[model samples]
Target: MAVRNADISVRRGEVIAITGQSGSGKSSLLYCLAGVLPVARGEVRFDGRVLGALDDEELSALRRERFGFVFQYGELLPELTVEENTALPLRLAGQRKGEALATAGAVLSRLGLGELRQRRPSQVSGGQSQRVAVARALVHQPAVVFADEPTGSLDSANATAVLEEFLTLARSQGTAVVLVTHDADVAGRADTHYRMRDGMLAPFTRDAS
Candidate 1:
């Protein structure tokens, strides 16, 4: 999807949900803001620095050191154990193996997956896998997290469970989140909601509920 114009501000610890159908430019806007994709027009700024202005190294460093991402599928590495996967971002950032795994274990415990940390992605249920993904995204205590259709693959009960934990952890750590989903129930969980259609964005209201 081509995102022509998308402008929004996300404050510290804020949860912003953008609801749009597939091909409605939701992911485009998200990747643009996360600095994964460059905007064609206008600018995307994080902490007063224009993303486009940053050189490749600077951008790479910024993304590595400060940003986090979670996709619809949880995208856990099938080869890695849950603990290993959750500790990956920290590992990539050069933290010691023991320290990273310990931290990951703590996060997994908090999310009620302590025992399952040793299990591989293929061994866990869909919801548990997504929680592991959330654990990974929050393990680094990033400035912001970008989640795309985070609960889209789960049943309603599992979806609610994962969403609640995701929001609770992010808010407690003062980490802002930008969530893009097609589900209204999930969108309503956000502090602010926006509707995206044909690449246009608008505030959503209860009347539209």
Candidate 2:
């Protein structure tokens, strides 16, 4: 099994972090919790609703409406402008273009990307592109955000800046954040920290050696 008996919970506006070595099943646990992967046993619940009980359409709708994701690579569509990419989630959730764009613009501004809204992802620096990705994940104000290696590609300075902005915005809006990374410094910033080893998940502390 990639992940075994992993169990955890997060509250509104709280930040949770999982740190583990490569192939230790950290991503597997994150995907299961996000409903992106099926649980072979046990279950995942969101807002009192069992994720396994929902049909695919229902699950898709739920995710689109209430969840967000950030990846190590930013994953912004190169063909789309920064603002358009940020607005994509709201658009997919049925918001009007005008309103979605306006909302996206606002988020981009808050993330210090207002002036670059019209630029494409390829036109920005790695740090700027990552910030745009953060803006996209947050534009919809989802109840939860799942981030995997969100800052693994950047230098320490850029990583710190992006993470600070990401958490500040999420916390301000009462959104829960689940982050997976191998960086101990990053994990230490979370309200709760867990370490995965050989497919098992367990609580972590600074004193743990």
> Model 1, residue 34: what's the lDDT?
92
Where does candidate 2 stray beyond 4 Å? 207-209
Local accuracy of candidate 1 as per-residue lDDT tens digits, 1-209: 78766779999999999987789898989999999998879999999999999999999988888988999999999999999999999999999999999999999999999999899999999999999999999999999999999999999999999999999999999999999999988888899999888898889877754
lDDT score for residue 9 of model 2: 95
User: What TM-score does candidate 2 reach?
Assistant: 0.98
Residue 196 error, candidate 1, Å: 0.8
In lDDT terms, which candidate is top?
Answer: 2
lDDT of each: 0.93, 0.94
- Candidate 1: which pairs clash? none
Backbone clash pairs for candidate 2 read none
